[model samples]
Target: MATPTTSTGASNKLLLAIIAIFLPPLAVALKEGLTGTFWLNLVLTLIFFIPGIIHALLVVL
Candidate 1:
């Protein structure tokens, strides 16, 4: 019961992390929506891929 839920949450985080690797803004948007964080991530992504990935991983995990 609780274990299943924990596994599901962990899998979801893994998926989000993968998505963040390719599309940081989309991953951030899925997790945090169109808030300041999302905008920041978008800007970071446009500025540089590495920074966006780091920010997205930090926010998602």
Candidate 2:
């Protein structure tokens, strides 16, 4: 059987946003795998506030 997935939710979202703001790569690495999401998260963080990147990463993760 396939393994079930888990989510951290909005609270995690806020956490991730804070992480993304100050931690950057750590937040992205937590939410997204090293492949695609990494670059995307980096770009989003660069383009928008850490919150935006955090929101995206939270949903994607």
Candidate 3:
């Protein structure tokens, strides 16, 4: 049995994970806000796209 909030959070995470595959920075920002993680993700994306995706996944999940 899952609480409503728990299920909703799971769904949100799934959606963000899908978005992270495409736009890692956006996904990080959505999950973590425009914080240092967001800045780091942007920098990682500029330096190497794959690292950015990996970082975003770590932050989100």
Ranked by lDDT, the better of candidates 1 and 2 is 1
**Top candidate by TM-score:** 1
lDDT of each: 0.97, 0.64, 0.96
What is the TM-score of each predicted model, taking all chains together?
0.93, 0.48, 0.90
Tell me how candidate 3 scores on lDDT: 0.96
Rank by TM-score, descending?
1, 3, 2
**10 residues in a row with least lDDT, candidate 3:** 28-37
For model 2 the local lDDT of residue 42 reads: 67
After TM-score superposition, the amount by which residue 12's alpha carbon in candidate 1 deviates from its true location, in angstroms, is 0.4
- Over 7-43, each residue of candidate 2 has an lDDT whose tens digit, in order, gives 4365677787676667676677777768676776667
User: For candidate 3, what is the TM-score?
Assistant: 0.90
Backbone-clash count (model 2): 0
Query: What is candidate 1's lDDT per residue for 1-61, written digit by digit as tens?
Result: 5798899999999999999999999999999999999999999999989999999999999
Question: Positional deviation of 21 in candidate 3, in angstroms?
Answer: 0.8
Mind sharing the TM-score for model 1?
A: 0.93
